[model samples]
Target chain A: MEKSLVINPDKCTGCLQCEMACSYENEGVFNPAKSRIKVFTFHQEGRFVPYTCTQCSEAWCQQACPVDAISLNLVTGAKEVNESSCVGCKVCTISCPFGTINYNQSSGKVIKCDLCGGDPKCASACPTQAITYVDADQTGLDKMRQWATQTDNATSNTASNA
Target chain B: MHYIIIGAGPSGVIASENIRKLDQNAQITLIKGHKEPPYSRMAIPYFLEEKITEDGTHIRHKSNSFNEQGITLVNELVSEVKTKDNTLVLSDGSELVYDKLLVSTGAIATSPPIEGINSNHVYNCWTLEDARNIAKKAIPGSSLVLMGAGFIGCIILESLLKRGVNLTVVEMGDRMVPRMMDESAGGLLKSWCESKGVRILTSEQVISISEAKAKPLQVNLKNSDPLSADLVICATGVKSNTGFLESSDIKLDQGILVNEFLQTNIENVYASGDVAQGLDFSDQSWSIQAIQPTAVEHGRIAAINMVENNSCVHHGSINMNILDTMGLISTSFGQWMGVEGGEESVLLDEQNFRYLNLQFKGEHLVGISSLGHTQHIGVVRGLIRGKVKLGVWKERLMNDPTRLMEAYIANI
Candidate 1:
């Protein structure tokens, strides 16, 4: 199975280290604005959601790209934007549900998280473990395991009553 | 086979690349009018904002990319083409012969006729040279006045804002992006930009600009008071570079007319990008689609037919445009402007500033326009391009247009 970048928003501290690392990794710059992965802050709710491209199965950005500028990486499961092919139309930026794919005006191309060509810098740079790269099929395993633990307690109570 | 491509813009470059890909031994020559590398005109705004260096605008990143692919790059402006002889005369007193020719000279920004419009401070954000001039003068806090509020103007607005200019936009139309959006959508966008601290003047025209020495130029408006600005940008519009072909025997109507195969009237000669008036998918009519996607598609199809003897056929180009202004997103696809006798469904949320307009010609969606609704926007393009049979979902969509995602899922 291909690997995916799993984001845990609850653990996000909004330190923006992942953004810095991501920009540095991909662009050789430390500017957060250049980073593909973004962290959204809900000040009133006191929540920070670190978000990036999910490398969606359907991949609207890939489909909407008229020139086939976007392609799927089989190994990483990341929707990669081919800079050579991209024409900076900004259509994919609109098609992206999460708005993860963006037009880079400087390069005249659409840019998104490519999972660092298989090794995501955002996952490693995250200090709070807010982001991690794991098996795509098992992305829901952690949540499933949490619910399974609650079932165990319920089962014990019924056994004791019997 | 010697293949010559005029205009080293995205279309010409892409076509040349494809031609070389199809036949490795073929002689490919790219004629660029400018001295710099082939760059996208869309990147000029970002360049003005200093978001990227000039070199970043290059379509190809690798050094000597053309030479690496064995494509010869010539720097010369093509003055004339002899279709019968399949030869072109360059401005530098040189002639080149080609077996097949692709004219993709693109377009030039139109400078509105106004007094002092040619002043040193006045600029158009069209080419890399124009971007350089604007960047050099558009210093932080410098007073800048933009002359148009169409799609291109709005795009440049964001970059100018990021540069911290005391920006003001003057539009002759009632609302911004008058060509792309309806009143409600354009109005919401105007308000959104106003909230973001952009001064907008609608239904106004710049009567004239007075040249001054060592002082801000005076900008006289049709309705409002005169304003002073250090720089004036003319985002008015663009005209195709077909003026050069007036002497040629090839057909011209606003732009170089091309058939569905992107072939011009003359045999073995073609045009693409802003220079070509290609077919519109919504209606079987020819129109100039100056957008980048259409240009790229035109280039690919033109190249394939040029090299492989009709290996590919171009159906038509969908009129599509998406603009991001100061973080506000707006999109228009196909015939965003409703056709005659078309049934329309509109969902307008004025409070939240979200709007959706869908135009249906019978069971198929011919056009769609939206604001602030980013998710699944591409589905509209899919539905329109695929011409999917919506069946009962068409009626359901007419009742509730927000079920677009559902309809797309069930149909496409």
Candidate 2:
């Protein structure tokens, strides 16, 4: 029943509005440089992708944080970072495979997406539903349905063709 | 020793976070030159209208969370980088070693070359500090001379007019945003700004800026008349912040040259934000741009690539910018269609501020420019993504941007 942010690259306008929203929600400023969610742009291809920590069930950042600052929220399944306990060693940054954990040299700590403590404004602020907070377990439902419809599109061969 | 980010702007910040999720043990350090925490560079103007506070635009009010994640944050201007030795010399004569580096120094606003352009009242609205300095002098009834009539300049004019500043906009080009949008769009925007109590003068060439403090400062233009001003804001254009890279071997034309991975010629060194530029992933090897989204995406891709064990994913940035003038959404994506993509056609809705121009090399949607709010941008975006059959949606796209949703396909 856990909710997660869904990103539809097709809908992304490459505006970085979601990034600003993320930074504002967590950092109290509109700096996209501090946002947890990111949107990638492929200029020549005219494509944009919004990316962030998927908040995996088996979270690597939670396990790698030696100072015990990284923990998971039971209610929302978010891998939250405890700022007070962090040592700024950046061990969790390397242990996690996706590169979602990062260090802020100004405060000497790591930062990432916490899903805005559950509501995730990135989904709400998106003018286009490129980023949406959806059911974590059924995250693949959209992709599955698209593929399912394609299965119905391919034409069956007639017996005479053999 | 896992990642070394050169700039603390949006791209470096987001990329570092992305890398951390993949590898928690990696050490990530972001170096920023600005005195305050990273804030939205675009929202600096909104702050002028008191729409948001200094704290309101801050990108990271809380850096402790990163400290908990074991990331190091450095707040100093990087003077030099020894990629040969993998070290960075800081402003305070300190040095930090790195296994990898990502640069997102961002772009610098173009300063008009007019004599005494550096005078007290001359303004540039690129940074928070710049905006703050301009705000101090923008008192009610102040006569302001705005140089340039582009998007930022236009927004500044609109925002300041609301404060009752007697404003005048001067542009060297025939129209605003001439480099990006066509003359048609620029003319439309100029007329729109004029309707809001701002004087618009095109084809203006600046000769000098002198002291006229007793009244308003005189902006002597190459044209017959001079623009008078108590305050002057320049929004001519922006140049990539690659002057420092001149000392290094990194390639630079208009900006720092990088590849699809956002990596520079110097190994283990990557750049993004304003200072970095590279070939477009979808077009010619022309310089990409200094836009924010592209920069952040470049940082993420570069961070992933810098981590060798699990090769991080990276992508290139196509030039795209959307202008939100408070509520009026002006979207410009892909090529102008008329510029590089080939023959172009148009669907104009002057009454609705909606104009959809379709550029095609026959059947593909190579470029599109929607002048007004059209929800079907998603569909247009999909076609631009190189999905099949752009012609199928041209008639429909002309009708509505929302139809793009129905035009989308899993494969396309």
Candidate 3:
């Protein structure tokens, strides 16, 4: 099964360590502007959403890319930009529904979260477990188990059709 | 099989790589018009701003990437193509033959005809050579006069501002990026730049430029006072580099003519990138969408047809341009200039520098131009490109365009 980055925005602290780790891992820099993953702070609601590419199965970015620069990683299920193939057109950046893919002015290329080539640095760098790299097929397993534990096992509330 | 790809720009290089992947035993030779190692022209601004090194402008970082993949890199210009002989005649008096050919020569920066415009201080920021020359003199406190404020000019303007130069942008058009953005949108950008301390002169013409030995040159404008500047950069526009093809049998219209398959009139000969006049999906028109993404799409579509024996067909391309001027983001998509008999909706907030304009034909959204509101940039394009039926959402959008995300989710 392909691995994926499962994000729980509620656990996010907005410390921005993930942003630093991402930029350093991919761009060899500590600049937050260069980070593929971004943390959006909703000041009024006191909430923070750490967002990046969701690696959609039918990704519009991969389909809309003119040069086919975006490709699906079989192991990580992350969409990777072949920098050499990308023309810095910003089409894929605009095509993505999440707006996670962004154009890097320094490199003149669009960048998105590539899950750090299977071992994502953002997940390891997160102190609050807000971002986790896990098996994609079982991402809902934990939620299903939680709901299962809350069920009233001893009560049968079914109506009989006599 | 042998493949001869002309022009080492993104389109040609990507096509060559894709072709090689499909057919490993095929002989591939990529001919570049310049000496650079497949560097991106888009990265030149970053190089000018000192954000990236010269090496960083190169698309591939690996050493001898082409050679390792058995793709020959020929740094030479194709002076002529003998279609009947199935061969290419290079400028160095060499002949190369191939089973398939791709022309992706891209474009050349156009210099307006003016007196002493070719002086030492004048430059065109379209190539690596131009970037290197401008970076040396675009220093802090240096006075620079930039001609034209179109797409390329606006991008270079941002870099020049970062260099701390006293920049003056003179545009012949009434507003900046006249071709890309509408009047109000371009006007807003001009004000935004002016607030950032850059001087903008619109609806103006540069009469003449007199060269100087080592001092500042005199730049005379038609409707303004004469000014002296340390350097003058021309960002007038670009034309397709299809001059060599003038003698060839290929059909040309502003650019080389290609069908939906991206094939030229001649069989086994294809064209992509800025040099090809492909389809515009917005209205099924034939035009040169010279932007980088269009070039990439043309390259991939052409490569698929070449490898699959003309089995693949292109669905056409949408004209899209996204510009980040200083910190402000502006975008235009599809028929942004508006189609005939189309209903239009606009929302402008000059104080906040936020604007959105949507064009509609019946229930389908056709064109969009926006500035500052970038949260859901994809929805407009998706709805327009997908040609999704809006239904009641159209009425809701006509009321307020900010509900684009809600519309996209409900429709798609």
Per-model TM-score on C-alpha atoms? 0.78, 0.72, 0.82
Can you give the lDDT of residue B120 in candidate 2?
79
Best by TM-score: 3
Q: How far off is each candidate at the interface, as Cα RMSD in Å?
A: 17.2, 17.7, 15.5
Off by over 4 Å in 3: A4-74, A80-91, A95-100, A103-162, B212-214
Q: List the candidate numbers ranked by TM-score, top first.
A: 3, 1, 2
Native-to-model Cα distance after best TM-score fit, residue B60 in candidate 2, in Å: 2.6
User: Ten residues in a row with the worst lDDT in model 1 chain A?
Assistant: A153-162
For model 3, how big is the iRMS in angstroms?
15.5
* lDDT digits (tens) for residues B268-315 of candidate 1: 999999999998878968999798767776887788888877656677
**Per-residue lDDT of model 2, residues A29-76, tens digit only:** 999888878676655468887777777543545543433456778888
Model 3 quality (TM-score): 0.82
For model 2, residues B219-255, the per-residue Cα lDDT tens digits are 8888768767888888888887766666766777777
lDDT of 3 by residue, B353-407 (tens): 9888888999988989988866547656667766778998788889888767666
Q: What are the per-model numbers of colliding residue pairs?
A: 0, 63, 0
lDDT by residue (tens digit), candidate 1, A56-106: 554656644544457777767677888766656686775443456776756
